[model samples]
Target: AQSVTQPDIHITVSEGASLELRCNYSYGATPYLFWYVQSPGQGLQLLLKYFSGDTLVQGIKGFEAEFKRSQSSFNLRKPSVHWSDAAEYFCAFFTGGGNKLTFGTGTQLKVEL
Candidate 1:
């Protein structure tokens, strides 16, 4: 069984500062990596994904992630974060065999102005 772990339960960053959220996974094979962001009272929005090929993948909302197979990590990064970027971020993994997705507890992001 695969699992996702988000070490940081909460993260605070200053607005306009660079941001990086950590995500580590435990899986036998190369599973799919996904980063989803959800605003308060809103549904989850896909930020980025890593399936195959290029290790580095780009996503919407000025987000990008690099799949490191050796490290078993798919960390999300943004050049600069905005106040609007404050939200709960989740890390998920899909084995591709099932429709189920194992997700992390989530990391609440706070952007201080």
Candidate 2:
């Protein structure tokens, strides 16, 4: 079965520091990858997505992810961490022509002052 994997359960970073959230996936056919963020009490919002064309896709809020087919990974990166960025980040993907996005456990990001 196709699935998304986020190895890190939680991550912490000081304000102004760079951040990276790891994501890996397994799929039978072409995969549509996505990154979403959920604030404390808000709904999940799409950060970025990679379907085709470029290997690296840019997202909102100064975020970007690179699709590495050889490694089956789509890691999210932010140049600098901010307190407002603190949220639960989910890595998701749709495989084998599915409408629903299969999401990983999620990686909680904590930012310090």
User: Could you give the C-alpha RMSD of every candidate to the true structure, in order shown?
Assistant: 1.0, 0.9
Candidate 2: which pairs clash? none
Could you estimate the TM-score for every candidate?
0.96, 0.96
What tens digits encode model 2's per-residue C-alpha lDDT throughout 2-113? 8899999999999999999999999977699999999998999999999998989999999999999999999999999889999999999986466688999999999999
Regions of candidate 2 where Cα sits further than 4 Å from its true position: none
Candidate 1's clash total is 0
lDDT tens per residue, model 1, 27-77: 998898899999999999999888899999999989999999899999999
Query: Could you tell me which residue pairs clash in candidate 1?
Result: none
Lowest summed lDDT window (length 10), candidate 1: 93-102
